[model samples]
Target: MPKSSLVAALSALALTGCSHADDGGPAAIAARAPLQWRSMATPHDRDRLRDWRKAWKTALPRARAFAPERTAAEGALFNADLALPGATPPIGEYRCRTFKLGAAGPAMLDFIAYPWFRCRVTDEGEALGFYKVSGSQRPVGLILRDSPTRAVFLGTLVLGDEQAALQYGADPNRDMAGFIKRVGDRRWRLALPYPHYESLLDVIELVPADSARETP
Candidate 1:
């Protein structure tokens, strides 16, 4: 799909946390754990929390980046092309945004808003529900699913909103489940998910929350 349209679709999808699935079982579970929270403390028995701001800032350039620079018409056409079969909601447009991480380079972030639909059957031979991304294909998203559910903000590893983080210490969308403690300006440490402390660094490249705002 055209880059422009992808952004719009993503934005819409982000606004609405929908998914395309034949079974509502997952959805039910997700709803139950919609938003959970935890805390990160030092001297964990297994995991060691290290600051990743420097490494993330260093890898910015290598990461691909994109920004919004087209008209709504262009975005519309792009979305149409991406709206393929099995595509939920059929995303139509999006706004591209970019976040620069010093020497690391720039990371592309899109704001999309759309619908989700899915179809599935239950064990009792009952037709399950249908879920799909509102404006695009299935709702393939990266969410932090700790005891609670925390939606990861698009193009950023940080929680989509403060409420998500405050409610659920770290983001559940990420592979590693742990607490995120800010050490410096835009810098944070992964306080959980033993053996994968470095993996958190990878997410930092995807979402540069450090630069979003200045920390005391």
Candidate 2:
């Protein structure tokens, strides 16, 4: 999916009454400051698989016992220009950054705000999908820290009616607890499972060219 399409899909979701304006103030203010989207950086290592597993262990203590059993075929590797269903056109680019998690290990973080979409089977085996436009419901964004550990963290902002969001967030079937128990802290993790291998685009700020700008 193109970045424009992703944005359109997300906007449509919002229009469908999936999100409520922040209760603090005027709706216009809320419109000006939409959600923000970002992802954790990718670690650079000769043994990425090993690092991933280690990270997962740090974040998820019971990973060996509770983590979803995924074959290499089931795992999807994402690039800077990955696209998904319902993505907006003109997918944006991304800025990758690396961070250190102290003794826990080195982590990578990427801040992206472009058109992206994802449809995945949550750890609990339920279907979870999203069409992301500008920002993300997840605060810290998606974290893919250690390779050997295969630790991953995701923060999301709940969209849609309170009931729907809450229901998904609290879904027991999804293996959300294992993921959250390892990484959930100041940033809350939804009890619901999130789709894996969702599509994503680059990050780009929307700004009209000077030629298209009106004269002052």
Candidate 3:
């Protein structure tokens, strides 16, 4: 599948709602994540990623052990962008950023009013999808990162933000449990935190495509 299609397929399996907003601006923040900003993963990051892989392998036997959802819309509200039948909201575009090279100070948890790392909160036909828009020059992998549940959608938004944050160890912290939320019309947020890398949580705010501003 095409890269964008891959993102859609993976997220659709778990996604399902929100407000209407204008189309967000172009990916102006994309420039910040220039090629020079990229870097290799740290040693600790490699170890943790290995662990995550091991865990996934261990869980493979039970990947299909859970019962199907009782209703099509049971977990449809994984986020506001998820379409709840007729009440679904439009997906928004986000600008992403990461703190890979080094933080100006100790990592702080604060609202990023500017575009650093952004992802699109996709509204699938009956599901929703999301993925990176900038940063790492890699095709991000999407996986359900939370405990098994029929009504929840959780995954990492990696290789993208900074289009780099903790960049948290490895790929979007497949273990960094997080989800989507509606903040306003044509606006949403994906509150994903890197597993164990608390200082680098991703509260990616999304603005509607219509809200996209011309690059200055």
lDDT of 3 by residue, 1-216 (tens): 233443333332222211333233112222223211012223443344435334333322222132123111222212323422222234556554331111113553222223345555464332344556665522233322222221123334344334322222234334344344444445444443334443333334445555663222
lDDT for 58 in candidate 3 is 32
| The 10-residue segment with the lowest total lDDT in model 1 | 121-130
Best candidate, lDDT: 3
Model 2, 1-216: lDDT tens digits are 322232332223224333565443332332354422211111221223224334433433222222234111112221111222322211222221111111221231122112322221121111112222233332222222223222333323343332212221223221111121111111111111222212111111111122131111
TM-score of each: 0.21, 0.21, 0.37
> 147, model 2: CA deviation in Å?
22
TM-score of 2: 0.21
Ranking by TM-score: 3, 1, 2
In candidate 2, how many clashes are counted?
Answer: 56
Candidate 1 deviation (Cα RMSD)? 17.8
Cα shift from native, residue 14, model 3 (Å):
9.9
What's the count of clashing pairs in each model shown? 58, 56, 36
Question: Residue 50 in candidate 1 has what lDDT?
Answer: 37
Would you give me the overall lDDT of model 3? 0.34
Q: Candidate 1, residues 31-136: lDDT per residue as tens digits? A: 3333221222212211322333333433332322222442132222222112222211112221112222222222322222122122111111111111111222
Candidates in descending lDDT order = 3, 1, 2
